[model samples]
Target: MTTFTLEPQDNGRLQSLCGAFDEHLKLIEKEFNLNISRNNFTFTIKSNEENPKSHHEKLIQCAIKLIQDLYMETAPIKGKAKELELQNVHMALQERRMLSQVEPERAKSDVYSSVIKTKRGVIKPRGVNQVQYLHNILTHDISFGIGPAGTGKTFLAVAAAVEALERQEIRRVLLTRPAVEAGEKLGFLPGDLGQKIEPYLRPLYDALFEMLGFERVQKLMERNVIEIAPLAYMRGRTLNDSFIILDESQNTTVEQM
Candidate 1:
């Protein structure tokens, strides 16, 4: 239901706005699979979705921003209100909507590179809270990653481990978790070591696989550079120089903790 009208202006300015938004609009269209209808400077969108309403408005705003940027480069312009075609605007918004859905996996791929790259600041600097806690771990040799998930505490720890190994600071990497059953009674399960432990440790394996590419992770496993095993096996072992990750700490009893 939104509308836009390009007012009378120098043909040069109109041409510049049109040219800039045209390709950008096309990219949006191809990515979002949307059709655009335009005449002179006017534009509109037609879509089958009920929520095409707000997306229509957003597309207009995006095209206007593109035009504003283009105009600033061509001829310095002060504050000027620009009207954008609804169809053109919708195209950009639809592309953006698609991008958001895949960003997390893309971010993980980027993080894997960051660890391998080992450039300064490749491992992002921790915030004040994380830095303070990490500093305590360095000073005290023990720290807890309490609080909710998605806070980057565990992931950052994994990153630090990778960084240390890449720097030759650690001889090996170790990861383990208590064999706590999710809900099914342990007695009812019918598998050996691999089957019983795998269910509880799959998350740790997934994190490792994400941080380290599959081939390298497999190579490390073969060379004993990386080890994922049951917590019981850790008993009576003296770890000299290694990176260790204890996942699912909440499931651990006081004796295990």
Candidate 2:
């Protein structure tokens, strides 16, 4: 068992960090499969003793750090604990741990200080994986980012695409994703083919919107400089001088790929 107490002991901040009914702590516990007992500002985290230096231990440590970081922020956490938020925390923990374990030579090679320039400002890699991902996209004919959700795989890809487009390295940007619904039928949804697939492609749209702004994105779409479509529509089409991004690629079938 590893135990520690947050400093100053502010009840309201502690409550905000833990959430209603300690839901946030429960989420961390469930994710790491550990027991977390809390008394005031003190927390005790316990896990199996077989592996003293397990990933779970690291997760707990990272979770504690995240909690402290959030508590110190000016804004307080509100509402119910969200799964996406927890997943992002977990992803950050994984990235931090991965970077710590990277060999010195590999770290030197993988580290990137270059930032991707966009209309929104500059986009930089948050971790070694992102640095390598961007490097691969810039160097290779085709690059893929495979990871769980909230890992910024799709977001970074879109950023790289946007940067490439801004630099005239690619004349156009093509964004596509498999039209797979999560326990939802496509026919049941309203609108035409494009409308039906809009939800699936919304993430890509959001990234583009953030990078290039709404008006510019709309104009680009009108001119076909930025094209968004379903993966099914990509058949029999040859792409050249285009930055293509396929999001939610795990849902894609073998034929779609």
Candidate 3:
């Protein structure tokens, strides 16, 4: 790593800016793995060996801003300052980068590697009675989890899809719905069919997000790995090894069905 010198102006300004606490310099040094030495006015920073200077500079700026805006006068150099200082710096840098591109692959990889297996209450496992019905549908390649709205019909259906995905039983999950508003045609609604139906599809996503997390859902969407679309989009395609959830069955015509 190379050494860089900060002139009195930069050093004095930074020290004055972060002078509220003694540990602030240590926090920055550890986070970016740099060596910081200062004597009242002049400061020198040895660059981090692992991360490039660009990342280090951005991190430094982040620490300075956090110290200026957030540091409390009464609180000693507790760990909270370090935590907040690091979080602010990372968040600012993340916002400026193409965060999705960097993060999604890691998310997908992590989900695949995760071993903490247990049930979360967001979606219940289908009961024996419901499982039997789902089994018949899976065997026949067509079935419906039909009932009134409050029941676990849609949620269970999505859960089955997720289960299938986790088991490598399916290559994808496809969620679609009929878009028939009482007053407006699908065309008159703002965007294309997918856009028009997104609001309606949100409940499906909510269920998925609860079972999975925000990051997994976003990564899946980015890869075209999971889809929630208007029923019309399902036309002229043969789907294989995938879970298909078609909501609002009442709205579809026999031909569409």
Distance from true location, Cα of 159 in model 2, Å: 0.3
Determine the backbone clash count of candidate 3.
0
Task: Estimate, for each residue in 1-257, the C-alpha lDDT of model 3 and write its tens digit.
Answer: 33333332343345433444745566556655666676554445656566565676755554443333333211222222222344443443343232224455642342222111112322222233344444554456778666776676776677767776877778999998887653446676698767877877778998888767788889998887798888888899888877888888778888996
The TM-scores of all predictions, comma-separated, are: 0.48, 0.60, 0.48
**What is the number of backbone collisions in each predicted candidate, taken in the order shown?**
3, 0, 0
Residue 87 displacement (Å), model 1: 24
Query: In candidate 2, what are the lDDT values of residues 3-120, reduced to their tens digit?
Result: 8888766666676667667776786677567788988888888874566666677667766765665444313223322222444445545555566677857754635434576656
Residue pairs with backbone atoms closer than 3 Å in model 2 (clashes) = none
Ranking by TM-score: 2, 1, 3
Candidate 1 lDDT over residue span 188-248, tens digit each: 6678765678776766666666667678889999998989887767878889898888876
Best by TM-score: 2
Residue 72 of model 3 has an lDDT of: 26
Off by over 4 Å in 1: 1-121, 125-128, 131-140, 182-187
